[model samples]
Target chain A: MTSRAHIAEVFMRGLYPVLIIASFWMLLRGHNAPGGGFIAGLMAVAASSAYALIFNSSKASKKMPLLPARLSVSGVLVALASGLPAVFQGLPYLSHPWWTLSLGGFKLSLSTVMLFDLGVYLAVWGAIGGICLHLIETIEENL
Target chain B: MILPVAPLLVPLGTSLLCTLTSNSVQLQRKISLLGSLLLLGTAIVLGVQVADHQSISLASGSWPLPFGIEVVVDRLGALLVFVAALMVLICTLWQMGDVDPAHSSFFYPLLHGLVAGSCAAFIAADLFNLYVWFEVALICSLGLLAQGGTLKHLDATLKYFALNLVGTLLLLTAVALLYGATGHLNFNALAMSVQYVNPAIMQAVTGLLILAFLVKAAAFPFFAWLPASYHTLPAPSLALFSALLSKIGICALIRTLSSIFHPSPEPLLSMLGIIAVLSMIVGVLGAAYHWDLRRILAFHSISQVGYMLLAMALSTRAGDAAAIFFALHHSLVKAGLFLCAAMIFKLSGHYDLRKVGGLYAEKPGLAAIFLLLALSLVGIPPFSGFWGKYLIVRECLVQGEYLWAFLALLVGALTFYSMMKIWLEAFWKPHPSAGWQAAKIVKPIPVTTGLCLLSVIILAIGLFPEPLIGFVNDAANHLRGHAP
Candidate 1:
């Protein structure tokens, strides 16, 4: 409505994507350090919270309808799938075996741990984001 | 090793898959039914494993015992998993007829979620893991209860949520305190660790845990949440809830009491006995008073659970075996009865016993199925409930606890009275509405077929109690041998 308000909204909008990117950064760094999927999920949700304040939930939801439910379902599958390779290998579920690939003297390392973290990230993102959006929508409906 | 987790995986994966495919309710229904079949297959595989090896335990993350989550399928857990699968499969079959796709997009997912939680709880080998599974079951139950979205449903869900939340919090706090005091969460390891801990702290933790389990089990004084919420559920959901939900709590109590607190501390055993007696009396009386078919069954659930707890309170080998058999018998017969009730509703358009009748003449086949299930529930001869009651009464008599023994028989008689009340009112009496005969449903073979299959299973278990009794006795021994 006012110039200052408009300026603040624009600034917050720019910070939103940065926060989204940082959530992934945190998720990636979580394996060996202080951050992980649950915290990363909070960060991602923080961006959405900002967006909900700036805009309206109907618009936000229209931009990505059914996103929350999909993320949650797919996240669960991803997580469940990550545990299967080990079970097939005659080890316990979620044993987190690792693998490495060499491409022209460059090595890429991977582990079930990261896949699991990704699943957790998506699941937490969806659950928390969906809850916030639902709450906001309910309030709007009541008003 | 794989089999230990397979049962949990099937249901969990199926639940999430159902969620992923929620857009097409018909497709979701098919997927979920397939999931139940898969779960039953997994349960069979795991059952054979448990039969051969006695117990299969897996430590998540490949960590050693006491360091990671332990998932174990002993004979009792394996058997319960088998029944849980059977109940879900049957309920899914019956619910497919009733659920409207448009409003029930989330039903399949929630149903599977509930089953997954119960399966996980059944097989969990450690305290914290059991708590997690219980929470999962609790959450899914709340979702399923609120699915109808009526004012009564919200009211019921709130009652359930409020009370169960307290129980859950107590369970968590108890687990934390146990971990803090004993430095172990694995049942086997904790059994060893508790030896060096102060008896007072151990007693406090055990009391809290038992109280939490009682609340979950719908045992006396803490059982108001059950009838308050359960009558609000649709018949299929009610059938599933009656079959699996409270039984998990009973299973948990039997496990925790036998494995960790066997040779239970002073006062707890008597306390359990008191709770059991009160639950039986109160539940049967309440069932007699309620006319709604679902509420009657719900109250009967509390009473039947009391029988299992009564067996547990006996603390003898025979007592433990009776408890396990009683649980198995109760799940099968209760689910069958609720399905029969659903069919009656379909035919007569009512759940109130006072309002509906002439079912015996309208559908003789359904009448027979209902009669068999009700007879089983009342513990008549040559039915599954007969064996459960026989074992408990025998154990009580053998133990020379005449008061409990007398009360057990008295409660059985009262149960028969209430069940016969349902029979006379719902099946025997003339239809109150003049046109009730016009609305009779002859199709929906799945409901009757499921009930018939269930009755046959109950009859088979009754006729050949030797094998199941043997299996349950083996499980009872396994529980005792868990303690260091």
Candidate 2:
């Protein structure tokens, strides 16, 4: 294994929490703002990749919660399933069905569009993470 | 309303399901076969609906037609989708016995993705949506072509990837230019706005778009990647590629020429015709020099595409009808031929005609099927290919383009020669070994059943051309902007 700089490892350890929170923030604001599924997914991937860089890939992969392919498959299924409810209601495919909720004087808006975005988030994250991990492993092996 | 989008949805959903179930090969195969059948049924229903109403257009997000993505099912699109679904079904069934276990996990997902992309491209009514679907199809195909992970497969995949990227870049540039010139991206809206755009800008856009599609379609001068790479992939993948990938390009060409650039400029028509003729001649010539069965078929695919494009170049209702008919017929026959080649490779352990022989004596049924598909491909009478070629030649004669008609016939004859060469070399010659007895054949049922199914379809179409002729004529009229 390649030796990691002590300072860099410490910095990545500190950065993970911030990155995760930032990605979720981006995901939530994505519907009305510039930040959405794609950007948020990239952010999450950046965080994970940073972890891989700081530690070795073998250790990092064991730490991962789900396989990248499975994550992507579930993401796609969720996105596709989100579209189904609208079809069942006689709306067109991917037609957003929205509802406004009152939660203790606060308005909470929910819709299938956000669910689709979330699915995209997971799908993109999984695809990029999986590819990055594979490449890193190959490079490490070559080294 | 839902019918317009069902074809795309079925495949997309199946692809996702396949990805989820990629761990189990048997399950993946079963799901894919079921999905293809559902898709075929959906396509047929959509065809009938289109016939009843002339066309069906659905805005995917329930947005207005101009702003939302539109999926339109007309006679031509429906017919192509139905044929594509059928081919996918056959290929999936063939894949059961053909695909290696190592590749099975990802193959079905990629196949479904490709099917979805092709179906979406066929019905896409917006320029950007078409581009999206093209990317989807391209990525899946690249994955498939590289599935074997051999050095040669990797090299072919790289070439395919690079050339196709260039094509996609050119298409994007053209779409951008078109949107800038007309300020519309939807097909119907663009058709209206294009008339008012500057003629020179429109001409440039048309040229670039045609060039991009030609590269994808693997026409002459841009077709080297096809022959270089297609023969290297696994048989079932090759069969699927033969059936759908280039045909998608042809479908796009037909759609663009008839709808977006109707009343085509004289120079454009002539240029397309020249390309068509060259593709036909050059493709056949290339095939004549190759002794590999798959390589020959790959070259012929280029030649067959030329016939479809030649019909489109005529820019008349008859031309449009003939182009659609030719594309559908060629997809089935070419795919059947590839599947047969796969069977030959399976039985003989070789793809080169020089090393393979005596198939006529050993496997008479397989030999007969090969003859039927090959004869059809050569445009012999009482075959599906004959009807398509007859229509295009007749249309050319009607247009007083005797040179084009003559060239078409000459290409047909050359195609006949190459097919005959394969037959003589591979089937008629005695087996090279003195003690040649048939080894125990393993699982011949799927391939045999698939070949027989294709043969019956080819024969039925040949014997009763009236239904397909009338259907394609209606589809042609629709392309001419008439509500038949």
The estimated TM-scores of all candidates read: 0.95, 0.95
Residue A26, candidate 1: alpha-carbon lDDT: 93
Residues B1-484, model 2: lDDT tens digits: 4778887889988898888887888888889999999999999899889888889988977998799999889998899899879888887877766422226589888988998999999999999899999999999999898888889989999999999998999999999999888888898898788889878888989999999999999998899889988888887788889989998889889889988777667799899999999999999999999989999999999999899889999988899899999998999999899888877777777889988888898888888889999999999988999999999999999999999999999999999999999888888999787776654456667766777888999999999999989998888787768521
Runs of candidate 1 with Cα error greater than 4 angstroms are A1-16, A31-35, A58-66, A103-106, A138-143, B99-103, B482-484
Docking class of 2: medium
Candidate 1 lDDT tens digits, B1-484: 4778887888988899888888887788789889989899988888888889979899977998789899989999899999989988887777656421115788888888899999999999899989999999999999999998989999999999999998999999999999999888899898778878888888888999999999999999899899999877776688789888888898899888888866678588889999999999999999989999988988999999899999999887789999999999999999888777877777777889988998888778888888888899888888999999999999999988899989989988999998898889888889887765636453466665667779889989978889999999889998988442
Candidate 1 chain B lowest-lDDT run of ten: B95-104
DockQ of model 2, rounded to 2 decimals: 0.62
Worst 10 residues of 2 chain A by lDDT: A57-66
Query: Where does candidate 2 clash, by residue pair?
Result: none
A1-143: candidate 2 lDDT, tens digit per residue? 56769998888778877997898899889747743988888888888787777776666555555677778777787887778778888998889889999999899888888888888888887889888877888888898
Model 2 RMSD, rounded to 1 decimal: 2.3
Displacement of residue B445 (Cα, Å) in model 2 is: 1.5
